[model samples]
Target: MTTLRTLTACFLTFLLSLAAAVAGKPNIILVMSDDQGWGDVAFREHPVLKTPHLDKMAAESLVLEQAYASAPVCSPSRASILTGRTPNRSTCYRHGHSMHPKEETLPQILKKYGYATGHFGKWHLGTLYKNSPVNPTAAGYDEWISAPNFFDIDPTLSNKGVATQYKGDSSEITMRLALDFIKRQSAAKQPFFTTVWYGSPHDPHKALDRDKVGYEKLGQHKANFLGEITELDRTVGELRAALRELGIEKETIVWFCSDNGGLKNLGVTGGRAHKGTVYEGGLRVPSIIEWPGKVKAGISKLPTNGSDMLPTVLELAGIEHQPKHPLDGVSIAKTVLGQEKAQPHPLGFWHYDVAGIGCWGEREMQALLKLQQAGQEVTDPKQLRSSGKPVKVSTKANSYPGHSAWLDYPWKLHRIESKKGKVSWELYNLALDPMESKNLTSEKKAEFEALKQAHLNWLQSVQTSMKGADYE
Candidate 1:
């Protein structure tokens, strides 16, 4: 009887511990749109486009009025979000750059805590082919349905490792796959972390007929663009409804944002410049987080960036693991949960412009697809051909050129250097000049000089990390 009692007690304890773990972990869904602008949503009062579903999400979410992507482009910003470091720190200097395999990613960190991780949709960080060092699976995803870059109608996506085609609007197709994954995980009573990256509203402007008819007056291109956004908005609605249906609505965190700035001349630029530029319009994106039970629905203007996402996820999930390197992002858990109103550090952004490893283009993708179709053996050529090596940045450069900015709330500073060694400084009080129309460097000499030094110090730190100092 004594032995039986001891075994029974042990079994009960194990069950309770498992229950506690499941109760504490939240289902995290991060949904990002490619090239969707800050002003693209109806809630932002865009003159033409309407996004009813996203507007509803904004109304219920903890919206960030001044959220920025770590970089002005897609791949670098995605790398920043995954690694909690700025693009320069990882040498993900521009679009199409693959993250170094050595870097620890968010999915890898969460996996230690028993989260079933999955990635769906666009994966520009690297190739989606099987065994690619930078593929979603290699980066720590347990399951993934993704494309090498932005994929469109009848998209060819790699499901785990096999390339398959899907019908319907790209946004809807991506969300359906994510929802299926979420549903399966929920049914199995497992916590999940899913990334749904939509390729819509990026280029070539192909939208569903049902979504485009309402915007016919805007011209074919504009109509298609806006229609794609509407499709994306619909997917957001479906995701929220699915979570509610799964009885986990209050226990999930739904975060939404654009990968980068809007395309130029579509009149959706949120600030001074568009897309590849480092201006406010290029970097600032519409962002929101809906954590039903924890975060109160509200708005905040505290400066935040893509690098902050990983740290924030770790903090919220109660996971503790030190990275092998430094992180640029500060956790915003307190702010999101209505406990704090400001961030601990200033946001820094830079465009190094120097290319890293070249992208896995159409040719490689075709070869992989043919192999999959033939039911033959498939392996990632890029990962097999190259060594998983750390990047080394030079420490003795006289000066770093290109655009780098230090954003400390209303005080924004820009350091622009030309290849000819001509350097210029520009400053703006964002409170007064949201458009960055006037340069305040001449007027605020003291502020300009101080911020310049701050920017330089930050640049040096990033450069040190790039040289693999953090790994030591």
Candidate 2:
């Protein structure tokens, strides 16, 4: 004899339980290393550099052999990863340029779904100190201890706009703080979305003596360079171990990648030329998505990049997200699960003519420290960047400068526009010439023309985006 009131109460209880379950989504940790090459890992047959822990992770997870960074440069790649759109759309056209205020970031979405979001280490997307409207918090992180650019030993970072000088290796300190945040979230029974971007193996390589022991056979600079990567590897191992100890490794998603390609001098790039170029060497990076038993193990030839991160993670969490603006990336969740193959969309890369805004890490940090010590709030407009405008590009119609590439898998096309406004084209069959040495524009006129047209159409869309047409 069930009463009507009892049935209603039961339905209400079920709704509450379902809401709680949705709130406890899987934890996601995205770790990115700066300047690490596609061949830097031991599994790639590197002559000396060894990454035992990363190799093990790759063995357990799906490896994207053809992974690309959204752009050949750092800031654009970072911006694309956060917003799942072309970086230039957000006004992050070059390094040191800040993201636009209107873009919806991954952390912002995750936080809305009851996740504790955090960002650690390099925050080169914008100025971290003083209230730049584009800082980590502005990007929707609940906690962040980040630097202006690629920082090194004993770096002074902004802890949510407060100047705090930390002691120890850069990656180590970043990981330690990230772990602390993870532990707190876990203790509170909250899911976390943490991003740890390490500043390692970047210019002016500084490595501790202990880490540089075996690399002396290489020149001092190369030794220090390799040593920094070695230390970065150790930090990665610790992060995995900590997840295991928490009994959440199987449920957590640990996505690892580098922002861009290796330096030309390093000779570690997998393709021709090096960083800052539109060639495979500059875009291709070592990427892995580890979810213990969830992600299928083995190599995936799918052409993916940082832009795919937001959509992929959201799909993995079973959260349906439709971006407010056009997305340059699509969800690769099926690919991760081994249910699908082949990239669903083509990736676009562009390097606009604007010069990168330079950021001096230590100097800026010291300046912030001085302001803090003087009991003055960060009111400097330059530090705040409220008036700092993006490089105006929409004013000129059909004025595409710098290099742009369209990677449509087997066939690739390049559109190079010199500062003098002279435009040229290069075509390569990547499946045949991975080095992109021999041009096939004249040989395969049909394929080249098709890609060239597609790329031109894409440029028009990108230009529209730059005009803020996509923002709702």
Candidate 3:
């Protein structure tokens, strides 16, 4: 009788522990690379620019082949990921725009559910020292070590609000800070939400001498650029190893992706155009999600976008509250878990008003540079106006009359209104031609018209969001 009682007690204890483990929420680690391209990874078959670590990550994780950034620029894409909304909806239509304090960020929402949040690397959303209500901490991160923009080697990062200098490669430094935070969180047995956004391979490209040594024979510029990416990959490996060392590998969900497209001048190892355009080579980036025990290891050609990350993380963490504003992205948890046969969201949208050399036009870039140089910050839309009305800016697209695209199902309809007011449409069956080389617009007139209307509707919705109407 005594033996039976002891056996029963042991069985009950094991069951309870199993239940507790199942009930425990997983930690989230969102790793974003600056100006990385979809073709950067070796697994993606880039002719050059080897990314062994990223390739390994893709092989051991869920790789989303058709993932896109929220915008062609950095800040807007980051905002969309943080807020679970489109760039326009979040009032982050362009680069250097800070996220509003009222917006609920992924870290903030997770914090409410007892997750300790840390943001390391680029925090281009707002100034580090400024008493702005729209700062990263105000947006819901408990601990923040960030740069105002894409930082170079040995960049100075603001810890909380105080500036501190960091040595070595930028990406490695960022990872070190994140690792320290992770160690602390792990020791405390607290779940953590960490964003390790590396400022690497962005322009004025600089890499450590040792890192560049391997590719020294190549052109100085090309060597430095590729070196930064290679170093960034090593940092990722370190972070993964650290997680395993802490015995949290199985309990942590690590998501790796890029902020925008790769740089073309730096040798477009990714696709076509580099950062700053709406082309597939510019907006589409590599994305991998790794969650041991939960997410199965494999490649998912499913299309995922930046806006989808927030919702996906929230759902994975079992958080219930959805933002009052509608989301452009849906939870990709099902796809990550290998439970879904297709992507959660059908269409990924990319829109930008500013036009110039890169994604924005030269005139727009000059204006922005002037403002930054003068230290005259433009935080609010009202501040953009000289008078009472909002400042109106035109783009090359505007000169072309109007340009719009609707990526519906497997078809992408591109409507180009020429300067002569001639409306020309082009259609490409993306399912068959991912490169969008073939134009079937004339043959698919009815389909093109339907998609044009859909694109217009989407534009109207985006416009309303930009005006902050949706938030109200």
Candidate 4:
């Protein structure tokens, strides 16, 4: 009887330990940079810019080589990250649109599990007005200090609903706010979700005087752009150090990535066409995730995108609230855990309807007005469209010639449709040509035809989603 009692005690102790481990949910910090390119990092072979901090993080984290932004611009990519749905489905295919409040955001989902959620820096999804249901607070963030758009140095941010001034480099200011939130959450022994979205390396590229001095020697605008990226990198390093000091480094999952591709006009190119274009250079960006005890260090060649983040985080937090709407992204928890060999999804999609100036152009504005004027009964006006079907508009072929691309397995196709209805297609075997230099549409007509149809099909699906259809 004594031996049996001792054995039972040991078993109970083991179960208790296991329960403690399971209850210790991790703190999540998602760090996003604005307009940063895939090749901006010093470790990525940019000759002049120095990003030692990011380089170090990459060395110590899971580096995703082919990570892409869901959209070629800011608002859409960010929406995808929050919703785990395609930008079109989220009604955020444009640069300055708002995400619907009815949809659950990553922070909101985590909040149900007792995570203190805070969002700092850029919050371009929507306005911060109390009437706007798409603001940070409406989306489930408990504390928010954010801007409606890209802000430079010494920016003004809306704290919850009030505007406040913050001095110092934009990146640093954002990081400071996040660090403060982290400290508070740590004191309470509560898990936290903080998103530090830096508005650097975008337009009017401004860096601290010291940061610009080293690049001034290069004597080019590209050098200035590089300086901004370096400054952003430094801020990231500072945040990571803070987490370590708080004894949370090993228990925190820190994800670093860009909102979209680089700006070519700034002389920083990713591969082809910059910024607004749909080329890989415009959509692909650098991404790294560091969870000291959980994610194994090394490079992951898997083709991941911004949409995958929400599902991954939900899984990590042990929250099983599947989104009410169909999600285009799959949880990459297996890949993060080193149990998967390849990406879980078969294909990724990208699409945009408003031409030239992006999805939020005059055309889209007019469309919104028309919807309002027609008294179209919308369950969620903030959503792209409650029906998931594209509003039928006369589409002129080749209306947006700047850049557009579709990637399916080994083949990638680019459709550059100009303003005059002239559509030109460029095809590249991504497995063979990552740079997308060769155009094989003429040589491989059949393959080109198949890919073209696929691209159109994707556009159709995007249109459907915009109408607010529940697309899986």
Candidate 5:
């Protein structure tokens, strides 16, 4: 009788602990748009575009007014989001570089805690076919419908490992796939992490006819570009509405942002130069997080970045496992909850001057699909979108080439290294000069010297990481 009583109590305790853990795990959905800028959304005073749904989110959620992408490009920023580290640490030096399989990914860690994870839309990290190391599945996502790069309308996406055709607007198609995953997970009462990476507002601005409704007056190019953004807004509304209808609105956390800053004329960067530069115009992006239960609605100018996503989500989910490698992003959970003002440390960004592997969307996918259906195999390494042979990354302590920047709050320092070995420095107090008009290196000698030394130390650490010291 005593043994029976003990067993009963133990079982009850187990059940209660399980329930508590489940309650703490929120349904996390990270939605990213490719190449959309800080001023692309309607709420940011965009003159022509109308993003009602996103505006609603901005009004009701925690808006990070000064959020930046880890890099000024797509794949590198995605790497930061996946691993909570900078791009080069994960071997993503350029736009189409593959994320290293050795790195610990967010989906992999979340899955250990029984979360159903799915990645949908533009997965520019690597090939979608099973062979690539950083393919969505290999990167730890349980389910994925992704593209090699930026897919467009009626995109031919890789379903699991098979290339398949998906119709409708690009952004909507991506959102619908995520919604399906959310519904299934909700039905099973399982926590989920779904990434709805929209492939719109990137290039070749192909917007649906209906979405082009109010933008006809703006030339054809502008109309199409704005329409793509409008389409994105509608999809955002759809995702939020679906969650509410499913009775899980308060239990979900939806984070929305763009991959990089805007283009020259088509979009607004909200800063100096457009995409590809280390300037605010290239790195600044629209970012918002909506969590009705824990995080209250408010505006915060706390500087955040893509590297912060993984650690932040882990903190929110109460997962305490540390990454086996160095992480550039620290948990900004307090910031999201309006308890913290800024990051604990400065953020680092580098535009590594390496060539990116080119992978087209429809053209390459359609060809791969035909090859797969014909029972043929892709044997060539170039055809497979990877070198196949092992390539060693350079890890010299003094080889910090290209443009790199360090943001330590109101002060930002830029290091420009020319191909001819000429090195120059530019310092700007972003709080005073958002456009980086004046060079304050001469005036702020103390700050300039400190930041330069800090950047050098960081660069050396990054070289160590590149040498596979982190994996060791």
Candidate 6:
């Protein structure tokens, strides 16, 4: 006969076991390359760039052919991916702007569920100095080894806000740091979320000696650029192999993408506008999602962008929260899991680089490096920011505009607001003219008008959020 005490003990044990199961969610690894264009991959027909690992991963995963970045710049796109909202919603107006302190981030959300979250490599969303209010830790990462912007060989990084020097290929160094964090978390039986942002293939591209040799046919600059991508691809292979060797391949969610489009002068943007433009070349990127346990090998052309990352990850982890702020992105968990065929909503892209923000991230990082070289502790928070006061955006005069687009598959509408406040619209049937060679505005007046109205409504919503309405 079972005693009453034994029955109570059994019930408690069952409850504890259930809690562990809930906390042991899939490990998430998000890897993004710097300035790697859609055509910069071997599988995508890059004449010189070699990406064997990425090609293999693409074959085994669900590839997104229509993947886009929220913005055509690095900082804004990174903010959108982390917050599941457009960069404007968080006031990340341009390349140097820091992430808003008030906004919730992906790492913070995962932390609520007992996940060990770490950010490694380029953290252009904000300054990575020890005391910056917008540092990775302030943005919800438990621990971070990061740089304020794009870095290269022999780069200086902040290891949990401490300036440290590392020597290696930048891509490989970033991955190794992330892998260390993953190994520690796995050994402790804790699920983890890590972002590995590689600072390769960006400007000042300096590929290692071994990586640049094969690209001799191209010019020196092109060779170096393509070589950096080749190095990045090798690093990808290393990360995947490490995960499999650790026996967590099936239980991990790995995603690979580029922050934005390729360089305009490279002639490698797949026949579209390059980075910083709202055209296909500037926005479109190579993306692959691999979850051996849940998602099958396939391909998707449904339009998606960086803003969808956080929501999709949250849903995948089964964490439910009703956000007070309206989300610009919708979760595509069902699509990834093979339960849905198409994304249910169209994506919006806007680019308005607000000037005169006076971002001090570069200055702060340089100072930190100097202090480190002098063997001084980088503990002064004031040194990490542009101003001594916490960074804040003025909510006045929200009517600023630049280029905005409404992308709804088969059709796209672009609204360009000139500096003089003159507005012009262009319409393109993407299916018929993927190159956007012909404007359909005069022929498809009805469709153009409808998309124009839709874009206007979206602009109003975005501006409202920008004016601090979202927090309320």
Rank by TM-score, highest first. 2, 5, 1, 6, 3, 4
Cα lDDT computed for each candidate against the true fold: 0.83, 0.87, 0.74, 0.76, 0.87, 0.84
* Residue 211 lDDT in candidate 5: 91
Residues 109-179, candidate 2, lDDT per residue (tens digit)? Answer: 98777788999999998788657887899899999999889989999999998999999999899899999
Q: Residues 127-150, candidate 1, lDDT per residue (tens digit)?
A: 676666767888899999887777
Q: Which stretches of candidate 3 lie over 4 Å from their true place?
A: 1-23, 267-272, 355-404, 415-424
Give the clashing residue pairs of candidate 6, or none: none
lDDT of 5 by residue, 40-132 (tens): 988988887899999999999999899999999999999899999998888888887888878899999988787889999999887777676
| Steric overlap count per candidate | 0, 0, 6, 13, 0, 0
Tell how far residue 321 is off in model 3, in angstroms: 1.9
Model 5 CA lDDT for position 160? 80
For TM-score, candidate 2 versus 3, the one ahead is: 2
lDDT of 4: 0.76
By lDDT, highest first, what's the ranking? 5, 2, 6, 1, 4, 3
- Give candidate 5 regions above 4 Å deviation: 1-20, 340-344, 379-393
User: What would the per-residue lDDT of candidate 6 be over residues 1-472, giving only the tens digit for each residue?
Assistant: 5698899999999878756755658999999999988888998887767889999999999998889999998888999999999998888877877777788888888887778889999888766766677888888899899987888887878888777778888899999999999999889888999999999788788888899888888788888888899999999999999999999998899999999988977736744689989999999998999998688998988889999988998898888877657889888889999997785578899898456243343355667778777988556555466452323544335344788899988898988877767778889988889888898999999998888888888888888888777777
TM-score for every candidate vs. truth? 0.92, 0.95, 0.83, 0.83, 0.94, 0.92
Q: Which candidate number would show the highest TM-score if scored against the true structure?
A: 2
- Give the least accurate 10-residue stretch of model 4, judged by summed lDDT: 356-365
* Better candidate number, 5 or 6, judged by lDDT: 5
